[model samples]
Target chain A: MRGYSGDKDAYLKRLRRIEGQIRGLQRMVDDDEYCIDILTQVSAATKALQSLSLGLLDEHLKHCVAEAVAEGGDAADEKVREASEAIARLVRS
Target chain B: MRGYSGDKDAYLKRLRRIEGQIRGLQRMVDDDEYCIDILTQVSAATKALQSLSLGLLDEHLKHCVAEAVAEGGDAADEKVREASEAIARLVRS
Candidate 1:
């Protein structure tokens, strides 16, 4: 509700579709789909996941992190830590 | 360089600080900061991290996902899977 605010439903719907895609990929692998084809599909899925992750990260910066920085309290420090962990995930992924 | 392509330096700087914040939190825990205070800090950090994650997710959706969906090829299906995994992470987090 915080950053997602008005876009929750849309975001969730998108996520559900992505999930289906993943399941499909699993099926493809199970069926012994061609290696290149499976990899192509995997690459596409990876890109999509990256897109979604980036979107959420942007919202967080614009709203929560920005606000905390402006407010300058314990909250700000905490936000910094939170943001760091998120970035770590992004980097690893 | 996909989504963060334009903002790479800025993003990296922000992430570095977040890492510091996390380290600070670890120190706080080690020093036995008040339970409430530690939790408060943890909460703040958690929120900040969520913000960052959401931001990245947003960008991915707007750029990569949108493009793939438009193209409607193997790419689109892969994107769908990728997006789904990202969402799953968000939800679990």
Candidate 2:
């Protein structure tokens, strides 16, 4: 099972909300809203996505990474390495 | 007119694409995809939004902020300050 399986509904809801925010951006552009206003909304949507990423990452570390660590082998090391890379991507993104 | 008025259609198209990415994320979650895979897609979506923001910010600096600065007054200072704040928010987000 995936790390986020238990929180699937919550994650889906958050993604859908972000999707709505993106659509709102389209409407603002269509109406020729001010540049600063649009940028503000963009920042909000970005924050939302970042928040979601952090939540997922937390769960992944708690469950997936923890599970591998408990198993005690090369797979545990690989999982740690993989999780670190994912965290790097999240930070850079 | 907004700084992005000329590129409204392009901006809307990019937002629509990002919306699609968000929906794809919903599907990934619903299917119980691996945590790492979902995080990877999330980063891709975040990057796309950031790129759009950078494009918009470039146009804002070139047009809106440029015009204000050209006029030479307190408005110009305010506009510059506002843009800087927006940039900071984007970076933090």
Candidate 3:
């Protein structure tokens, strides 16, 4: 079981919503919508993805990392390191 | 005709690819993939959206905003202001 397994339904819903947003962007382009308007939608989609990332990260830290820390071994250290790297990627993205 | 009209097909292709990425993310979640792995894919999708925004913004500045500025009127100022606001939103997102 993964850290996000419990929230799987919620995460899938968010991803599907974001998928709809991406489709909306394609439609806007097909109709020759104004560039700024398209960019605005792009920003909205990006923000949604970012929010999802943050939520997943929170759950990973709270569950995965916490469980590893409770075990107190090299696996715990590796999990923490992996989570940190994921956080960095999320921030930079 | 919009600034991106010339690149419409290319833009559509990119958006479609991002849509695919979003769907792939949904699959990852449904399969109970590791949290960090899911986060990685989320970052990839977010980065793709950002790159698409930058491409569209560049074209907008070169065409829409440029044409308005060349006309030299209140509309030009408004276009520039709108572009700036869009840039701000992109950065904040």
Candidate 4:
């Protein structure tokens, strides 16, 4: 229950909408919508996602990393490393 | 005007909501809600994000990568590489 076990409904609700958005984007393509229009949708979708990732990263830092720091030891080091890697991935995206 | 220049309003709208969700999670934390509950929110948030990334990746493959494949050459290679890197990052996340 410590990992990915909470707020399932809320997450699912948001994801369902995002999924619809993606499908709508596909229709735009199938209909041969302007290339720029499609790219714009893609950008918007990606930004929505990037915002989500950033939020998760923020939580990880506040909770997971902070907990590790309190414990003090290898767990602390590992959590920091994991958080750093997550940050790097977000940066690259 | 090619990249991320289309559907700007739609993108902004979606992002705004996702932002609200993140803030909700943060408030959950500040209130000292159960760790698992907070984690559940984190999981939900991360999954939402992963879904978004996957959508963008899908569009990139269908449109950006497809265009490059049609051209065939250094540009093709670059586009494929970029797409691949994006995939690798998503997978890792």
Which candidate should be chosen as best, given TM-score against the real structure?
Answer: 3
Give lDDT for model 1.
0.69
Which ranges of candidate 2 are over 4 A from the true structure? none
lDDT of 4 by residue, B8-51 (tens): 45544554555555667656645555444444554555555555
Q: What TM-score fits each model?
A: 0.48, 0.97, 0.99, 0.49
Residues B27-84 of candidate 1: C-alpha lDDT, one tens digit per residue: 9999988899888877777767776777676566545655565555677557646765
TM-score of chain B taken alone, every candidate: 0.85, 0.98, 0.98, 0.84
Could you tell me the TM-score of candidate 4?
Answer: 0.49
* Model 4 Cα shift for residue A73 (angstroms): 1.0
Per-model DockQ: 0.03, 0.92, 0.95, 0.06
**Cα DockQ of the candidate 4 complex:** 0.06
lDDT-best of 2 and 4: 2
User: Candidates' lDDT values, in order?
Assistant: 0.69, 0.94, 0.95, 0.58
Model 1 chain B worst lDDT window (10 residues) = B61-70
For candidate 1, the per-residue lDDT at B71 reads: 56
Docking class of 3: high
Each model's interface RMSD (Å)?
Answer: 12.3, 0.7, 0.6, 9.9
lDDT of 3 by residue, B1-93 (tens): 999899999999999999999999999999898999999999999999999999999999999999999999999999999999999999999
